[model samples]
Target: MKTIAINQYGSAEEFKEIEMAKPQPKSDEVLVEIHAFSINPMDIAGRAGMLGSPFTDNWSFPLVLGWDFSGVVVEVGSDVEGYAKGDKVFGSASSSHSSDNGTYGEYIAVDNTELTHIPDGLTFDQAAALPIAGVTAYYGMKHNLDLQAGQKIFVAGGAGGVGLFAVQIAKAFGAYVATTSSENHRQLLEDLGVDEVIDYHKVSAVDVLHDFDAVFDTVGDVDTGLKVLKSDGKLATIATQPTEEQKHDQQKQVAFQFTYGTGADLDALAELVLNGKLKLMVETMPFSAENVIKAHQTIEGHHTTGKIVIHVKD
Candidate 1:
């Protein structure tokens, strides 16, 4: 099998193409023939040795570093249930590192419980893009912030991967969503159902929007997030966290954490995709060595308006 890995952490420029033996599924895993995957900022963060979690902490070079995937099951574990050969599956990997396992390869052995069936009508590219960003946005709104209908909400970095999904999910739940993006992304966010769009480069979100309800901060702007919240509002940040004292003094639901991907969370993302309730704009790139390098370069620029899909195979 062929895979792309980083022998040393620095930039996506370090990705090395290597050939390795295909892995067999364990008793609780499935061998998936990967069809597609998404390029996310986390990928860059991991490649740069910036992640604080186990995903990147203490990781050595020549590591396989990918997470979200959409693929077909070629084989299944003996203990797995409700799944079989030739099942179309798509979901996020429960664990990631260089040597452990990753999605940036021709095949992957993922725990059965960690994946969900792809919706009948969705394409591989669409399914591949859903896991990381979709679930993060879904879980952030549904579980972390407990966003309610008719409430006003703000999504910082709303043009980025997770923010694109966050805006759509918030609208599906009947919330009035305000997102921060540059002028380039205004139309895109509007089409995705964002009620208000703030230009983060020119105007600070805190200065312009007096928020009620929740603020989903994909950007590292917890300080500004606190400034814009109402007394009862919550702030959920995927970036740096606030101190315990800050949370206490704010007197709101302030949480700083990453999305712990679960079966239920992945299902919610699929349900939204299957029902025509959620819409995502994606740019697909061929999964070649050249394209992979280019994808990393584009991601590093941090101005992409939607998910970047790596078309791995059929």
Candidate 2:
């Protein structure tokens, strides 16, 4: 199997394509032949050696850095049920810090609990784009925010990977959604049912928006998010945590959310996709070291309109 990995963390230039032995499934795992994978902000952070502590502290050199993948199950573990060889599947990798279990390769041995079948109408690229970003948005809106129908919510960085999903999921839940993005993405987001689009470059959301039921901050701008939020509103951020002083100054509920993959959540997202409630906007790239570097650079710019996916097979 061939994998793009980093022997030492630094820049996107650190990516190198290398050959490694294929993995066999454990009793509760499945061996997947990866077809596609998507780039996320965490991949950049992992490549830059920012992922710390229990996640990557013990990971060895030549660590593979990816989490979202869609592929075909080539082999199933003895204890695994409801999945078989040749099943099309997609899911996020459960271990955040493991050198041996990343999706930036031809194969990955993943726990069965994290794997779910891709529905009939979905492609591998779209499925791969959904796991991390979709699950994060789903969990943040459904769990962290407890957003109710007819409520108002604002999403920062509405053009981002998670932000795109957040806006659609909010609309799916019947909430009146407003988000901040550049002029280029305004029409696209409006097509996805976003009620309001605020241009971040020309104006500030704090100046015009107020009294929101919830705020979903995908960018690290928690201060601006707090200013636009209602006194009793909840704010959920995946980008960064609010400082203690910031938290003390505002009595609103705030949480830093980290999403883990589960088959049930993936199934729910798949249902939304099948029902035409959720849509993915992805830019596909071929699998190569150069393209990986390019994708990292594009995502690091923090202005990408949608997910960037790498076609690993085919």
Candidate 3:
């Protein structure tokens, strides 16, 4: 099998293509023939040595580098049930640093629990785009902040992958969403059901908005998000966190400390997609070891309005 990996952890230049033994499944795992995978900011963060997670140092060079995948099952381990050969599955795979599963390859061996069936009408690129960003938005809104309908919620960086999903998910939940994006994405955000669009570069968070039931800082700009929180409201940040001094404030701010992709969460998201309540936009590109650098560059630029996918198959 052909795989794209980072033999060294310095730059996109470090990514290389190589032939590797195809992975097999364990009793609780399924082997998937990957059709497509998406590039995310996290992938760039991991490559840049910036995301200081436990999984960071666990991976050595020549390690696969993606989490979300859409593909068909080729083999199922003996203990795995409710799934079988030729099932169209898609979900976030745990990294190689954790359990030898990552999606930036022709094939991956994943625990059955981490895989979910893609919605019938969605394409491989669309399915590949949902897991990480979709679930992150869902968890942040449904779990962390406990947002309610008619409440005002702010989403920072609302035009990016996670941000775009956050906007739609917040709307589906009946919250009045305010998102920050460039002027170019204002109409896009409006179509996604955002009540207001604040250009972060032009309008500061505190200047344009105040008093919200929840604040979802998908881009991790904590200082701006905290300014608009109502007294009892909570703020969820993926980037910069609240300091001890800020946490002691009366607004009762909360930050999202990142969560692993879960089967239950994916099912919830899939339900939304299957029911025609959720819409995801995907930009698919061919996946080859040679083009991995181009993919990384596009993600790093942070300009893509939708998920950027790489099809692993020729």
Q: Residue 47 of model 3: what lDDT?
A: 77
Better of 1 and 3 by TM-score: 1
Clashing pairs in model 1?
7-62, 63-98, 64-98
- Against the true structure, candidate 1 has what lDDT? 0.83
lDDT of 3 by residue, 69-144 (tens): 9999999999998889999999887654342356888998888556788767777887888888888889898988
lDDT against the true structure, each candidate: 0.83, 0.88, 0.81
Candidate 2, pairs of clashing residues: none
Q: What are the C-alpha RMSDs, in order, of all predicted structures?
A: 1.8, 1.7, 2.0
Alpha-carbon shift of residue 215 in model 2 (angstroms): 0.7
Clashes of each: 3, 0, 2
lDDT of 1 by residue, 1-314 (tens): 88887787887788878776676778988889999998888888877887776675535656777888999999988988888989999987755433636788888888855588887788999989888888889989998888889999989888888888898999989999998888988988887879999988898887788956888888887878887888778999997777886587456788886677777787888788788778878899988767777888998987576788999988
Winning model by lDDT = 2
Q: Is candidate 1 or candidate 3 better by lDDT?
A: 1
In candidate 3, which residue ranges exceed 4 Å CA deviation? 51-53, 95-100
Taking all chains together, each candidate's TM-score versus the true structure is: 0.94, 0.94, 0.93
